[model samples]
Target: MLTEKQVVELLETIYDPFLKKTFKETGAIQEVKINKEKGLVSVKIALAKTGTAEQLQVQQTVVQRLKDAGASSVGLRFAQLPFEEERTTNEPIYLAIASGKGGVGKSTVSVNLAVSLARLGKKVGLIDADIYGFSVPDMMGITERPVVRGEKIIPVERFGVKVISMGFFVEDNSPVIWRGPMLGKMLKNFFDEVEWGELDYLLLDLPPGTGDVALDVHTMLPTSKEIIVTTPHPTAAFVAARAGAMAVRTNHEVVGVIENMSYFESKTTGEKEYIFGKGGGQKLAEELQTDLLGQLPLGQPDWNDEDFAPSIYGEDHPIGKVYMDIAKKIIAKLR
Candidate 1:
């Protein structure tokens, strides 16, 4: 025979796999009934969403743990909490990466940043919200299109990060010639139709400049923050400032600036050549009142034929280490 307090102590050790919190912390164990004579124990629990594999796992674990704790039989049942409560408790942080112009390695930085964050044990999703100029799929080497599960689009997972891109929908690299309203609608669909299951972060790779798609993203994600990307070129930094300004105007926090291709490093000599000139990233960060998160050197990544992503480096690679450091700083800033 176990006391109610001891039963709760046992239940506290059981964690909800999806929420990553113990049952006691989640207020999941609503009721616990025990019958010592019959060796029966019953628990009523609350779940954020019902009938998912995670919920089923939680139930199974609960029953097994209780049985192991001395109950001959355990009865379990679940009631779903309000939808609003669930969403409010588990909303993901949305971060958009932007540049004032193209050819600054914005998409590359976006892919690697998302991947790096995922490597750091955070659930991450990357949206190629570049719309007409979408290149996340190409840079990521993603060829498979997203799958439609019922009404929701399942984002393709690669390198431990979930990804959705317009490239998956285009035909033969044909241009997306939709008007502004159509573009907005498509961007809306990416958010509304895609089934991103409880991400820790959602990174939007916005098209360079304050274009239709960029504006749409600003409007769609009013609470979203931004990371500005630029090269070390003076002209490039000047243009990137405009993107940072737009983020400010839209009330999005400028988390930091990443200056890509800041230099080229010689492998044998171990010397850094400032091919693009220097100080652009620092200048932009100063102007935006944010940190210069990182300066990425120029070096083509080694590709594997079997891999589906480009510009991806392992955590130990030089560029990969830079991105991981940036990811850590970004996480700290967000916190």
Candidate 2:
């Protein structure tokens, strides 16, 4: 059986997730009781907010630590902190890349924008919030999975960007069969459970269309800014306007519109062909009352076997330069 002093010392290392401080620093461990003969321990904790996912995480940590310290069982109780402490941690700018429909290269745009921002020396993180159709990990050529450190999941870093995706959790390219509530819970975990160190921008690659997951993100990050992606086709642009409207309804500032696959350029003749039609990007931007950020030409990235990412474009590639300019515009608008 452990003594009360021993229990207190052991719990001092546990952190209050929201406060980002240890139990000792916050004095959150209000009471500790130890039943010596039965080796049972009970502790009462105080946190900035109770009954949250963070609180549940803290409870699990407390219980596990007590058991490891020779307690047969652990009982935990939580209460809201009496006084709110000013949070000193800097929150990252939340940006969501969305589209009104699928097959518009929304994920491709998302992956490159994150890489472009990182290339510009901005600390960036990307979340594959398109839960049902997660492709970010493979798109970025991230082969490794996130590792658990204490109570937090450390995001995988690639190209100066920290990334978390549902693809890392599933095996053998299996399908996710979860419902809405479960998907929302997993998305919340991406925010609450992942350790994204100081990030200038945190971008969410939302599922195309105004659906449940998108709605959940709008609800969760009330101040998130959104960018609508569309092709130059009239139909694609017409559908994309609905996504912009959804962002407007949620009070998310529509940063700008990006027209992807606007045209195709010939390698031999150096001639440009308006393959998908023209002016759709401008039309959507006008509808959303925002700027037309850029029109991307249809082109494939020059692949490097050494560091091969299927969707990412190099900084010098023509399309890559377009993305860089778009990234700069985004930084300017948001900052």
Candidate 3:
């Protein structure tokens, strides 16, 4: 069992996310209770803000730290502190990669664009906002999970990009059965509680269509710029326009459109095969009143068992160069 004084000392190291001050400095640890017989510790804390994702992070940290310090159980309560102006941090340029329907390679576009920007020496962070269809972690070959330090969840870094995904939280590829409100809360937590550090760009890989998760992201990031993904097929591009329309409705700038699986290039004859048809990308771009970012062909990345990122393209790969060009266009447009 731990003493009340010991608990206080432990908690003093934790800081209030909004206030940016330790519990000791802020005098935010209102009460501490310890039960020796039960080896239980209970604490009541106040922060500059409550009922936020930051509060939940602080609660988790307190519970985990007490348990690690030999407490069998821990309980925490939170209240809002007296008024103080919350500190502000530099916000990154928000970019959301969305598609009207799945199987159009939206996630593929997102991962590649994020990696390409990172390759250009830009600080980038990726949020796998497709809670129900999260795949960024596996696509980026990330084998590690984010760790909690103090009160913030540190994002996992790979290919020079920092990333957080719903895939990390679920076990054994379990389906996320959460409702809309719950999913929205988790998305908010990703933005508010994750320690993204300094980032030039933060990319969101949204779920397909105008779903709840997509709506939540639009509401959360009103200033975000979006890139719609579609196929060269006319129907695919037509459906993709709906996503672009939603972005427009939410006041998000439609930066461009990317037509994926545009064509396959034969290795033997080096001929271009328009498998998904053509001109859909230009039509969509024209309708959206934005530039055609790039067209990606149907192809697989050269697999390397050693590094082993199934969906990522090497910088020197032909398709990878196309992504780099699109990334450069994005930088120029956004800047």
Candidate 4:
């Protein structure tokens, strides 16, 4: 027969798969009582959530480990812990890549940053939360819907980064009319349904400006920060500033700013040209009191250029170097 202390020692070695913590560390083992005379040992355990296979497996493993550790008989049961349902605060930093204007290359920045992060050997995920104009599938060259396993939806993976987008669900030529509660529920499903596992960063590509979708994200991911994108054109910067300020109001920290279409490099002349005025990026960052992270050129206007694929799937292109620099700045700012 085993004492409660000995049983607990063995139980401590069993870890919760999802939470990535040992039972003992998570306070899952509430108490251990060994009724030596009755030849039974009972464990009161707390689970992170209801009906998670991983949690149930941890419970079963605890029972076996306790019995194997010398308990004559074992019983394991669980109750929910109120606060454990939130994603581990230890999980990777989440950054929302948003723009105040459409056609500013926000999705492109999100996709490239995700790729750049993965190239640095960090596990990364990109969530295309822009329901109205989802573009991740085209940007990533993915055509398949996510795989469904048990209760978890596995994001589509390519070039070492995992991606999930509404583009995978709705019609190609058609637009989604999801509104109100339905929209919120569908977006929330991405959190609960997707098996993100562990990641170093998860970038959400939000649609332009203050809108219903942006509001939903702020509410759901209260800790997520924002990175506003803008162009060098003054008015665009003015509008982009509103976005940064809105993020501040929502308690989402503005990590920095990105200026897309800041300049164009003449392919033939090989000279930098600010086709769209100037100073918008720096001006926006200055007003927001944040870093002017980087400027992305209007490189090869058609992303479908045969050369672009190599950049994503292969090692590095000159454009890849630019994105890598921005990725470095982003990681530094987040830290």
What TM-score against the true fold does each predicted structure earn? 0.75, 0.84, 0.78, 0.75
**Where does candidate 3 have its weakest 10-residue lDDT segment?**
82-91
In model 4, pairs of residues that clash are none
Best by TM-score: 2
Ranking by TM-score: 2, 3, 4, 1
lDDT of 2 by residue, 1-335 (tens): 88999999989878777655668877888998888877789899889888887788788878888899889999888987766453554568999999999999999999999999999999999999999899999999999999999778999999999999999999999999998899899998998888787889999999999988999999999999999999999999999999999999989999999999999999999999998899999999999999999999999998999998989999999999999999999999998
| Residue range 1-335, candidate 4, lDDT tens digits | 88767777777756456454556667777888888887788988776676776666676777677767666777767877657443553576788998888988888888888988998888998899888788888877776789887457899987778999888887754888876677677787777678787889988999898888788999978999899999999999988888898898889999889998888788789999899999999999999888888988776423556434422523355566788998888877777
Stretches off by above 4 angstroms in model 1 are 1-88
Better of 3 and 4 by TM-score: 3
TM-score of 1: 0.75
- TM-score of model number 2: 0.84
The worst-scoring run of ten residues by lDDT in candidate 1 lies at: 13-22
What is candidate 2's CA lDDT for residue 14?
A: 81
- Candidate 4 deviant stretches above 4 angstroms: 1-90, 301-315
